[model samples]
Target: MAALCGLTSMHKIWDKLFKRGEFTELDVDEEVAGFAELLRERNARRVLDLGCGAGRHILHLSKLGFGVH
Candidate 1:
């Protein structure tokens, strides 16, 4: 999660790689679930999507009710 990530280039790559442009609803849902689960397991109180150039993960985390800083 934010506390564990670098908030660097890797996040930008994730934004592109996880782009939902061509993803189906199920795929998006799965991604959200997976991300949320990871955060939960990490007990992350904050999340920072590294290199969130386009804010993809930022938006996703927000949608998941995370108070991104």
Candidate 2:
């Protein structure tokens, strides 16, 4: 389908950008910090990052003591 092809093209573009070190900033956004707080409040110890391009959130969450994958 055209939609599927478009998605694949987008994926390739993102992969290239990631390889070039784009979107690799480690600074966690305020919203993510707030979400981390909520997770902590709930006693959540782990996070699954399904599309963790450049692993920014994974690293941030790990530093905050959550196991990130």
Candidate 3:
């Protein structure tokens, strides 16, 4: 499945089919773990989540203390 969705580029397509319901919560930890480092370093309090779609990422980001604007 990784190769099919371009394993190297997984983020954008991950939620399309995988990030839903129980599975949605699973991805949250990993995405936050990875991006949190950057957010802290850059002090990215306000997040502009383009193509937010159902807003799964937005919710997670907000929980982590981001303004999520």
Candidate 4:
């Protein structure tokens, strides 16, 4: 029960931050471009972006010809 309450509080904080665009950068991370290049070299066609806040990486990966989830 305590853990659930903590999780709920954390979720609310994050939700507020997201609503304010705190971590919502439209530009992809610098590391992601290099990582995507490596994926391409390996013939990777899909990516799973865990904890994908705001979906910036999703958009970038999709633009680079990889399916993103």
Candidate 5:
């Protein structure tokens, strides 16, 4: 299973599929962990998560002390 809707370059397709909650079976903890590490390295205090459907990433970012919008 693809972490975030496979390796498809076209994000719109994945966005549509994800928004409908079609790909909930995939595990993305590793990806999230890597992203959190990157944010910490960059000292990311704020984030603008556009197209943040379901607010999964947003929630994680919030927990990491990022002011997500």
Candidate 6:
């Protein structure tokens, strides 16, 4: 379908940019940090990083030992 093709095209663009490290310095903004704190406080063992983009927060959570997906 056209929508699926559009998504594939977008994915290719995003992948190219990410592979070039264009988003490596993406900020772990206040909201995300707050979420991380909450997870830490609750001793969460797993997290679902929905729409994780370049994976900044996912990587952060993973470093803190959560089973991030």
User: Each model's TM-score, in the order given?
Assistant: 0.44, 0.66, 0.51, 0.78, 0.55, 0.70
Better of 2 and 6 by TM-score: 6
The residue-by-residue lDDT of candidate 2 on 2-60, one tens digit each, is 99999999989998988997887778889889999999999999999987466777788
Q: What is the C-alpha RMSD of each candidate to the true structure, in Å?
A: 10.3, 2.6, 8.2, 1.9, 8.9, 2.1
Each model's lDDT comes to 0.68, 0.88, 0.71, 0.86, 0.76, 0.86
Sort by TM-score, best first. 4, 6, 2, 5, 3, 1
Using lDDT as the yardstick, the better of models 1 and 5 is 5
Deviation in Å, model 3, residue 21 alpha carbon: 6.4
Question: Model 3 TM-score?
Answer: 0.51
What are the per-residue Cα lDDT tens digits for candidate 4 across 1-69? 999999999999989998998877778777988989999999999999896466787788899889877
- Candidate 2, residue 65: the lDDT equals 94
Model 2 misplaced regions, further than 4 Å = 1-12
- Which residue segments of model 1 deviate by more than 4 Å? 1-32
Residue pairs of candidate 3 with colliding backbone atoms: none
Give the least accurate 10-residue stretch of model 5, judged by summed lDDT.
1-10
Q: What is the lDDT of residue 62 in candidate 5?
A: 84
Best by TM-score: 4
> Model 6: how large is the Cα RMSD against the reference?
2.1
The superposed Cα distance between candidate 2 and the true structure at residue 65, in angstroms, equals 1.2
The lDDT of model 1 is 0.68
List of clashing residue pairs for candidate 1: 2-48, 7-50
lDDT of 2 at 56: 79
Residue-wise C-alpha lDDT for candidate 5, range 37-66, written one tens digit per residue? 898998888989886465677777787789
Error of 4 at 47 (Å): 1.1
State in Å the error of residue 58, model 1.
1.1
Winner by TM-score between candidate 3 and candidate 2: 2
Candidate 2 lDDT for residue 50:
88
**Of 3 and 4, the candidate ranking higher by TM-score:** 4
What 10-residue stretch in candidate 6 is worst by lDDT? 49-58
